[model samples]
Target: MMKFLSFLLLGFAFLLTGCSEDANVIEVEHPEKVTVAFFEALYNEKNIEKAASACSPALARIIRHYRSPQAVARHMFNMSYDKVEIKPDDSGVKVREQFKNKAIITVYFDGYYQENRIKDVKRLSLIQQDNKWFIDKILKDPF
Candidate 1:
């Protein structure tokens, strides 16, 4: 009876805690959405901390190292995404790419910095940690 009670209490505790990403900020589930939101927070809202929150620990460190959010925002102001492709795995529609903890999201964009008319593609490395996806790295590819 004591064992059953302990198990029941443990289950209840898990239910109460849930799986919230962060208590202070909005929770974004998908990797693609998180990437878009990160850039939006950085470029549009000019919130470096908020942008950093959407990234992995390493990327967050880089963002925090910047002098000011406004400066980073200014540098990225011209960038805009054309599309995002989330790599699909054998899991199908129900749990696409569920088997893999890490994913690469391809972001196609136009108008980056001084080159307003140029088109470019960037691959964002994302890792699922604590049941939340965070951007870990950004890789630029030649057009």
Candidate 2:
């Protein structure tokens, strides 16, 4: 009887662990993370609304106008990937510039498109409103 009770408790614990894993909401606590999450939602997860949540109202509207994640990725961002690894560029060449309520960050994308590898870099302008960072614009690539 004790063994059966222990097994049931273990099963319940496993169930709880699985439930927590299912709630995979991205965290956007910082500018770099927000940028990464935005691309991940758009490219890998293919979730347009989730991606747009990290953008300014104007930018979000522009993104939504594409109608689908694929359209947004292709026409709007000009990059599409089957799998992607996105990160902020930390090469010390150009450090992240943060002003009173605005910041500029550069992000790097290394991914595959149709089994071919591709890389791209983007400089993003961000603004803080109500203590939350929103992507205001995608600056022209400096590379």
Candidate 3:
């Protein structure tokens, strides 16, 4: 019985051990790839809510970011343009360091302008809070 208890405890510890790194050394499941694909699907469908849904909640207060999934949904449901699309450029994460229950993603992408086929690139910073990722802020770097 003692041996079994020890083994069980060991297993639990292993499962609990998710590594957390500072700044750039964090390990995560293909964050960049997932972000890219998610954006593609959301923009192509013009499903703004679904697009914002991929992001987290804590990032709402940041400038150049969405307040909530509902906010995005409302905007999409009530947009003057009615047609907005996002195309990703190259994406790299800034804060790979995993927190207790959050992560951050900074994505660089290009989007199609609604007035015409002209394209405009946008660099977006996102935060993952409560197991969800959301827009953190809009960045100004092209590269």
Candidate 4:
């Protein structure tokens, strides 16, 4: 009976470890993916530090200055959502505009705040350093 109880506890511990929040983090292997992950972490997960992890050092410092996900989302990004769905614009290769170590990606945000629907588009510039993509800046909206 003692051996069976120990085995059961060990199995439960493994299960708990597998269910940790870290498991839900998105792995950004590409420029567009990083842009999407940035907004998702900020708007959906409401995690400022996690969102800043996808940014360049300069941009991350700016984001961190806000100190809260809501502040970053509202002031920096100029939008807020209780829940959001982000997708890269799939227009074409010409639209994506990826170069050797730089890329410009456009993403769409569909979200809601207090039952009010909101939709916005953002253009992001990214740079690759040490083979990892980081968000460099958010371009001004043209429209």
Predicted model with the maximum lDDT: 4
* Cα lDDT tens digits for candidate 2, 30-84: 7777888888889998888878888999999998898889999888668989999
TM accuracy, model 1: 0.59
Q: Decide which is better by TM-score, 2 or 4.
A: 4
Model 2 segments more than 4 A misplaced: 1-27, 92-97
Count clashing residue pairs per candidate. 0, 0, 4, 0
lDDT of 1 by residue, 84-139 (tens): 22222223343326546777766554434444465545567788888788888775
> Distance (Å) between predicted and true CA of 127, model 1?
0.1
Clashing residue pairs, backbone N/CA/C < 3 A, model 3: 55-133, 55-134, 56-133, 56-134
TM for candidate 3 is: 0.39
lDDT for model 3 comes to: 0.44
* Candidate 4 clashing pairs, residues 3+ apart or interchain: none
In the order shown, the candidates' Cα RMSDs to the true structure are: 10.2, 5.0, 11.4, 3.1
Superposed on all Cα atoms, model 1 deviates from the true structure by an RMSD in Å of: 10.2
lDDT of 4 by residue, 30-116 (tens): 888899888888888888877888889899899899999999988977887999889998877853343878898999989899999
Predictions in order: lDDT:
0.63, 0.83, 0.44, 0.85
lDDT score of model 1? 0.63
lDDT of 3 by residue, 33-142 (tens): 44654455344454444444444444322211544433443353222222445444444434455553343444443334355443344455555554544454545645
> Which 10 consecutive positions of candidate 2 have the poorest summed lDDT?
91-100
Worst 10 residues of 1 by lDDT: 81-90
